[model samples]
Target chain A: MEQSSCTVVDAQETFSRAREQTLIESVKGGDTLAYHELYDAHVKRVYALCYRLTGDKALAEDATQEVFIQLWRKISNFTGQSRFSTWLHSVAANVTVSYMRKQRGWFQRMFSIDESEAQYHAAPADAHSIDLEALIVRLPERARMVFVLHAIEGYRHEDIASMLGMAVGSSKAQFHRARQLLKAWMGYDED
Target chain B: MTKTNFDDALKQQLDTLPEEKHPERDLWRGVALALENEADTSTAKPGWRSGWAAMAASVALIAMVSWYSLQQPSGPTEPSAITGEALVQALSQQHEQQKQALLVEYTDTPALADNWQQQLDELDDAAAAIKAALAEDPDNPALLRMLQNVYQQQITLIERVHAPKWQRI
Candidate 1:
């Protein structure tokens, strides 16, 4: 008899187990190569996060590298208390936001009164092509990061709170604010 | 434009992102090499023990290099400023120190060691470009600092990998 196809649940389980195990061993064997493999697997996703956070490709690229560079410099502290991906996103969010603060004028460049009004109506189809990715770039720094982690990347408000050094409710509120902004920009009603 | 309507539209958009964008494998290999160099030294552990040690080493390394650069007094005056991007890129090269722990954290697959020596050479080229840029504008403190950092990081990585007793593997 033919074997049944692997279910989504099974695949997820297999992948997670494999990933977790790989990390555990690499850490044990003193394999820096393993450390980078993990970084490589996730750099683009992290870059997408930074790009959305900064809305400037060059700045985002810097922030993206900083996130991994920080991770590489600090991965020895990754206690398996929480999921590795969760911790990684937390670092990505914080680093991007901090870098954005230093950048000084990103908000106005992307969302000034004139640009918002202009982009609102004729938002291109390609706008949503990188849905979570593109929607993120349009968000203000804090809200963009909150929404990226909670709504898109799927972290809980509590986890976001801890990672970002904010209150849990605030994390929830920011996520909502981000969604509202995205809706408004994308031609959605506030309610 | 309604809330529900927006959610539908946004959901549809979110679902459309391409599953993957194949990285320039060649470039990624270089990045991988750097990460390996960062993680190469140190014992692996569950949490911050190893990380803290690495951070301490990095800070010390940076400080030492900065001190050494300053001590040269005759090297260059009016250190040029570098773009923030270049500063971060320079820091990104110590891949040797952090790769091993990452391997343990993600254990199943073997970590691939790429052509790190080639990446180091690429870094020299990049550093030369940055230095040339700084030469044109020597008054920029930021660029000057970055040039110093890049120069030091490249020298250190080269020294570490090419040390008399060490092999690339």
Candidate 2:
């Protein structure tokens, strides 16, 4: 019975992938309806990544829109070397970062404004009830970005460094900083 | 929480994180609009080239308008000589004829921008405002100039977005 169930699961996975590949081909052929279907399939995952990276609902929404717009233009570039979800995530990360940079003022970009400290707000009524997502959002900008990219998104420190224009050491340090902050917010005792 | 316990808890939370999150509002509309705009432009020309063409057209229109304005009378004129209402009506008629001709010329060609109609509507609003101001000051050359400029912009926009690919070449 177990062996038969395993075979069924494998068969389902194969069917799902084949369907996705067909959908991708249809979208690349300039079928707007097929593109809409593709968007519906992946938008939630894209939106989640955007929201986690930006930590703002409205910014996430805008970034999601920009990502889809870019995807429509560049869908032909996907060679199917990797899973489509993986390619889409990379696109979302890059687009979100670029969108955030464009939203910043020239002065901020030029001056390299320090955003290392968390933006303060009233604490949750019960500290123990605070969720990990809330704590992640309270992290500083660079640390939050590094944490989301490296820890959650499973990007290597090297790739994170390149994406954020930082040294690998800096990316590692930011990840550590983010972990420490999250632990503290969660009421963990330091070793 | 102990360090070991915290590590375990963090790992569990990370593992359990939801893979999907839906936005409060539907974002498909904005994406569709943008894609439609891109398709409109990219079908006949590359997006970057279309952008450049639009910019060049704008500059040419500005230069022509400046040169023409320089040759015209600057001072206020008699209302009876050329009333603002009559000027608006004449310009509107000329604009409509030119617009129709351009539309017929490009009837088979796809537009270079999806929002061209929206842009025309916005220009129409501006012309109406200028018309209202001209009602109070029928002989204001400045008002007349503004009205003429708006009309010219409408015509320029139409010509730029609907220019056939052969002309671009």
Candidate 3:
């Protein structure tokens, strides 16, 4: 009975994967309906990533829209070497960072302005519902980005460094800074 | 909380973070509209050709303004005189009128980027800086050219962002 149940589960997984591949192929062939279906399946997760990365709802919405728009254009580039979700999340991260860079002034970008604390204080009342998330937003900008990308998004420190244009050491330092700040805010006793 | 306990608690909190978060607003309409516009722009050859033509015309206008400004007397002059200052004023007035018209025409159109106005303002600031430089060296062809390029960039940006749907089709 257990052996038969395992076989059934494996069959279901195969069927789901096949269906997703077909949907992706149709989207690549300029089928808007199929594209819409793909969007519906992935948008929530994409928005969640963008929201955490940006720490703002409106920016996240804009980033999510951009991600989908670019995804439609670049869907054909998916060689299927990795899972589609993984590829899409990578695309989302790159697009959100690029979008934010374009939105900032040259002076701000050059100086690497740390507005994370100010933004945290100004965070909407609704964001305070989650304790850790609120604290994450309060971290300094670089540290916050590193933490969200590493601790939350499961990216390697090297990947975070490349994405944010910082050294690997800087990425590690930022992550450490983020953890210390979060711990302090959470009232964790530090030795 | 002890360090070990804190680590565990933090890990738990991270684990509980939802994988999916629906946006407060339905974003499909905007995405669909942008995709449709992208398709239209790519398919419409005449519109693409006209975009290039418009850019060429702008370049020609800039040259004309620079030549005309060069013909006028250099150094401090009457406010109403047809010097570089007058040319700047004329260009600024024309740019403002065109911008306002574009804004009105695309009042309902969704902009592709949220910070386009801020970008335009930044370009305007660059233009102002060039104009200030021109004030010190009224006959400086380089300064005049730089100012013209900045203005051209502003016009291009505005048109690119708020381009009329009908025009593309």
Candidate 4:
């Protein structure tokens, strides 16, 4: 009975994937309803992704809008070599990271952590979410970015290295550094 | 396709990080308006593919600059394992890759100048000379600047040939 239930759940997931794939095809054809459906399904997740990367609600909101707009413009490039959500997440990450970079000053490009550490801490406190998300926002810029991309998004260090233009070792080091910093701040062992 | 499962202290809390975090305001309205705005631009200015050409040019330019900066920096530089030779090889490989892609893309596009290929060949020779000079004096700022100039010229050549400027009437 347990095995059969697992099989049924797997079947349901497969069905959902197929349905979403078909909807993506419709979206490729510039179907407005299909686009809306895709947005309805993916917006919150995309927004969350943007928020985690930017650590700013306003910036995340802007990045979310930009992601969808970019999706509409570049949907024709979706070659189906990867899953739609995977491709969409890639787009969202690229958009968010680039947006964050642009919003930085010339000095921030030279230094990973900005003076905004105080500002990031100054944001409103969320009572219910004192876990990873809160600590994530508290991380310095580079560590936060590496942590989000590696830990939260499950990107391999190799891919993160390429996207962020660093070596694979540095990417791994950043992830380690991020975990240690988070653990220190949270006063616990996460590793 | 990220596996959100964690196996540490925050495992339970991490599990609670929902896949979706709804925005405070409805954003579809802005998206719809943007779609309409883009639609207007498309119809108003036909064949905006040049915009992509422009963007590609910018990306390639940035990549070249980034490659240079990564080579000549201390903090946040490329991995320690990548030596100066590897840096040169990487930059050359990146240049060749982008150059080939540009050639393929602009194969049928009308050239702005009949002598553009000759100009590119000359720039390539200059870049080669600069590389040879840098090989002798790796830390020469003048040589590095010249190398970057050569690269910038190559990208400018590609962009000009593929996405020529519009002349005002």
Per-prediction share of native contacts kept: 0.25, 0.66, 0.64, 0.45
Candidate 4 Cα lDDT to native: 0.70
Query: Candidate 2: misplaced stretches above 4 Å?
Result: A106-128, B44-169
Q: Give per-residue CA lDDT, model 1, range A33-147, as digits (tens).
A: 3554576567777776666656667777777766766676666677767877777777788777666655656555434543433224444444334345565676665676677
Q: Per-residue lDDT tens digits of candidate 4, residues B1-169?
A: 1123223545666667888898887777677567656655675331223333333344446545655665665665334445555656777788888888888998888764444576577677667866886686564454555666677768777776556432111
**Candidate 4: stretches off by over 4 Å:** A1-15, A106-113, A116-129, A189-191, B1-7, B43-169
CA error at residue B135 for candidate 4, angstroms = 85
| TM-score per candidate, chains pooled | 0.48, 0.62, 0.60, 0.56
Q: Residue by residue across A44-124, what tens digits does model 3's lDDT show?
A: 999999888877789889999999988887888999999999999999999888777776652485356665554334323
CAPRI category for model 2: acceptable
* Models ranked on lDDT: 2, 3, 4, 1
Report model 4's interface C-alpha RMSD after superposition on the true interface residues: 8.7
DockQ of candidate 2 is: 0.25
lDDT (Cα, tens digit) per residue for candidate 3, span B15-134: 988899989987877886787667566864222223333434545466556656766878663453466667777767887898788778788987644446766776666677667767
Stretches of candidate 1 above 4 Å error? A1-3, A7-16, A27-29, A81-83, A101-132, A155-177, A189-191, B15-169
Where is model 4 chain A poorest over a 10-residue stretch in terms of lDDT? A119-128
Candidate 3 TM-score for chain A? 0.85
> Model 2 — TM-score against the truth?
0.62
Which TM-score value belongs to model 4?
0.56
| Interface DockQ per candidate | 0.12, 0.25, 0.24, 0.17
Deviation (Å) of A11 in candidate 3: 3.6
Which whole-number lDDT from 0 to 100 does residue A40 have in model 1? 58
Candidate 4 versus truth, CA RMSD in Å, comes to 23.0
Candidate 3 vs candidate 4: the DockQ winner is 3
